[model samples]
Target: MLCIEVLVEEPSAEAALKSLLPKLLGSRARHKIINFGSKSKLLKVLGQRLAAYAARINKGENLRIIVLVDRDQDDCQDLKNKLEVIAVQAGLTTKSNPDAQGQFMVVNRIVIEELESWFIGDIQALRRSFSSLPSISPTSSPFRNPDNGGSWEALHRFLKKHGIYKSSYPKIEAARKIASQMNINENRSPSFQCFKAGIEALLSQENENLN
Candidate 1:
């Protein structure tokens, strides 16, 4: 079995991915999501962790690592390149640098702005999670481009306008709720699709290896 180890930026992303991965990978694939509390913490230990994994892989461990983090103010490609560099420095090959059969050990994903962008991508899932939410078209402006600076605040205001969760945006709870209803087959967020595509490609490779 293929073991996909996911490194996420925070507990909310961990919660969200935990809820979504099973639906995406099915019962066959084994996966784990690890959170580092913040981006700084993640980058701090990432190199060492990847190095350890590289050693284990040399010992015949069937493992793959996927790193996910919010893009925030950083350049998306730059962040991805940085992660790939870290992986390479730890003696691991990335999708950007694959072996003879194009096999890569690490996949890095950047969530544009924030993970809230994904929630904004599938407003219908939010509506399903919170029935009181007003009907929202997928083409709505805020939903169309969720990379706004204050995405969480914007989402909070939008939900508050509908008279739901007026106090604050419960990050973990909201993530889990929305993820439960997320349509993995379709999402408007480019970042989310990139994440999904990475998982699918890994799964496809796993299947080929089994065959």
Candidate 2:
């Protein structure tokens, strides 16, 4: 079984990803994420800290440990540090090009921090993407079981909860909400499938318009 380990700061984001990431990536298990309470990055954390965390996992060698980020609160430099810390701590072997003073195959994501402002740059969306769970409602459950319906539905629900879908009319998330409200989940939420799809669609549309 393929496995993915994720270190994130937003519970909702993790939940959103959990709903459809496995399906989208054809993963065997949902990506396991670690959302630290105080906003520590991969670099801020120590090797011992990472060892402690990674050791507490069920997934083995065929695992992809990815850290999803929003990068709202962290500076770019800060984000870089955090990613470095992740590899140093996870006990994942890294080959050092001692001459250049850098290690090879260090895992992390710095794109989120840069995309934070464009994505939402707010508390609700930030928390959702980073692994912070606000008060969940009775109508919506946060735990995602792909075996049930996959992430297509769960991510749609999350967008509504955080107001990401409603705020932008005719946007991907908004379109998804409309489709979901009408019970359409056969192929990627009728809009794109997941947030990632919506993003891709928008980018492609923009590129087409540019050309």
Candidate 3:
């Protein structure tokens, strides 16, 4: 079995992943989710942690690491390149450079705008979480690209306008609620699909090795 170490940006992301992974990985999956307080903290210590992980890998430990961070308003390619550079600097392999067999150690993904975009990706999940959430066409402007504004704030406004959550967005609570209802294999967010694809690749590689 492969051990997965997921490094996330915030408590809300951690909560969401905790709820989603079991469904994604099944009852027998082996993984650990670590929240790094904030994105700043994560970027600060990511290299050091990757170095430690690289050392463990050298000792024949079967491990895979995933770093998930919110893209916010940063340039996506630039962020990914920075992450890839850090991983390589720490002596770890990345998807950008693989061996002849195409093996890599770290998978990095950015949540477009914010993790709440994931909930927005699945309108049915939003409706399930908040009964009063209006059924807008998935093809509509708001639903088309949930990353339009501060994704979380956009979600807050949507819910507020629809007579659901009247106050502020409850980050952790909302994550747990909406994530539990998310269809593991059927989200429309490109970033979410990127995340799922990375995990699926790792799991597939692990299974192949087991055989």
Note the Cα lDDT for every prediction shown: 0.88, 0.40, 0.88
lDDT for model 3, please. Answer: 0.88
**C-alpha displacement of 184 in model 2, angstroms?**
17
Q: Residue by residue across 54-113, what tens digits does model 3's lDDT show? A: 999999999989999999888989999999999999998887766678889999899997
Using alpha carbons, what is the TM-score of model 1? 0.96
Q: Estimate each model's TM-score.
A: 0.96, 0.42, 0.95
- lDDT by residue for model 1 over 1-211, one digit each (tens)? 8899999989899889988999888976899999999999999999999999999999999999899999988987899889989999999987777778898888888898899889888877988999987788766768867665567778888898888888888999989889989998777888899889989888888788899
Residue pairs with colliding backbones in model 1 are: none
Clashing pairs for model 3 are none
RMSD of each: 1.2, 14.3, 1.3
